[model samples]
Every structure is written in C-alpha cells, then in structure tokens.
Target: NNFIPFYFFVDVYHEGLQYYVIRSIGGNLILLLPVGLLFPLLFKKLNNVKRILLTGFFISLFIELAQLSISVYIRSVYRSFDVDDLILNTLGTVIGYWLFFILSMFYKRVTYRFKSNTSINIE
Candidate 1:
C-alpha cells in the first residue's frame, strides 16, 4: 500500500490512460498548486519560474524521502513514494507561478483604472 511506484497506472493496465490522469498526475498537480500559488504571494523573490520550480521539486523530494523514512522505520510500506510526484509537483509550482502573474497583472490594471477615475477635483 505504501511502495507503489506505478500503482496508479500499472494497477489498471486495461483501464486506459484516464486512471493515470485522474488518480496520479492530476491529483499530484492539484495537491501542489496551492504551494506554488502561496509561495510567490508570500515571497516576492520567488516570482521567477525557475526558482519556483526548483523549490517545488526540492519540497516534493523532501516529502517523498520523509514518506520513505517513515515507511522504512515505523511501518513497512506505509506511504507510496513515487518519482512521478516530484515531476508533477514541480510542474504544479510553475503553473501556480503563472497564475499568480496573471492575477497580479489583472489586479494592477484594475487598480490603475480605479485610481485614475477617482480623482478629486478642486476648483
């Protein structure tokens, strides 16, 4: 139950690719998207995509290693540690960085418009 590297995909070989997307890739990506989004928001220096991706990758790796350690020390196969998770998590961070950039751009435009429109006229 814990050491399934390709469990999501190989477990259901006849189930088509949908299983991989729904169970593995999509889930991993979604789980980490928030990390990507929040990191940039909290740390302005993480605005770069490369930096975010690297950070996300390291974070995912750390999680996987921790899971492995727990599984090895406490219980056998307690958590599934997969390499795919690292890739997906890093991708999620990149996506999150882009989302933040887009949202910030929109926010700036809106604010600029509102400020210009709200001018105080003193005759």
Candidate 2:
C-alpha cells in the first residue's frame, strides 16, 4: 500500500528504470481513458467536467481498495495500491472528457452548417 503520490516514480527514475516508469504510469493513464470518453457519451448526466472528475475519482479509488482487499485476503501482494494511480487515472479521464467535448463541438458545427445550407420546401 503506497499512499505517497509519485513516490514510485522517484525511485524508478533513480534506478534508471525507464521501462517501468513508462509501463506503470502510461498504462494506468491509458487504462481509464475509455471511461472518460464513453461515460459522458453514454450518460447525459455525466456531460459536465465536475461529474466526470468525481466519477473518475470514485472509480479509481474503488479499484485501489479492491486491490488492497484482494492482496490481504490472498496473503500475497497481488497488487499494491498507489495514490499516483488514482491521480493519473483521473487525469486520463479528464483528458478523455476534453477530447469528447472537442469532437462533439466539431460535430455540432458541421451538422449545423449542413442543415443550414440545404432546405426542402413542401406545399
């Protein structure tokens, strides 16, 4: 159980373990990117940034706690809980939310232009 944020990062860097840093940090960040992108699209209530942040945080926290519980139950270190994972995962979610926001805005603008340019008259 590692509660210190970015603590593993410092140790890995000192040891010159670039691969570990990339795999750990990058993997965690990418792991939740889909959650951020899909949650807002699937649930209209999660369209705002604040809602996305909270959802991401709670989800990451649950995963960490679950890992801790599983490790304790198995009497082995199945996975260590790290605060940095929560931070990176939440950041990934926010990044995904922004990407979704930009895509939605672009879609709206394009569709509006298309609608405005063509008209059907009926009598």
Q: Write the per-residue lDDT of candidate 2 for residues 1-116, one digit (tens) a residue.
A: 78998988999888999889989888888888888899998999999999998999999999999999999999999998999999999998988898899989999999999998
**TM-scores of all predicted structures:** 0.83, 0.94
User: What is the Cα-based TM-score of model 1?
Assistant: 0.83
Using lDDT, give the best candidate's number.
2
Error of 1 at 67 (Å): 1.0
Query: After TM-score superposition, what is the CA distance of residue 14 in candidate 1 from its true location, in Å?
Result: 3.4
Model 2 lDDT, residue 6, Cα: 93
lDDT of 1 by residue, 1-123 (tens): 334555556556556666555677787888778777888889888888888888898999899898888998986888868877877787887888888889889999999999999999999
> What TM-score would candidate 2 get against the native?
0.94
Give the clashing residue pairs of candidate 2, or none: none
What is the alpha-carbon lDDT for the whole of candidate 1? 0.80
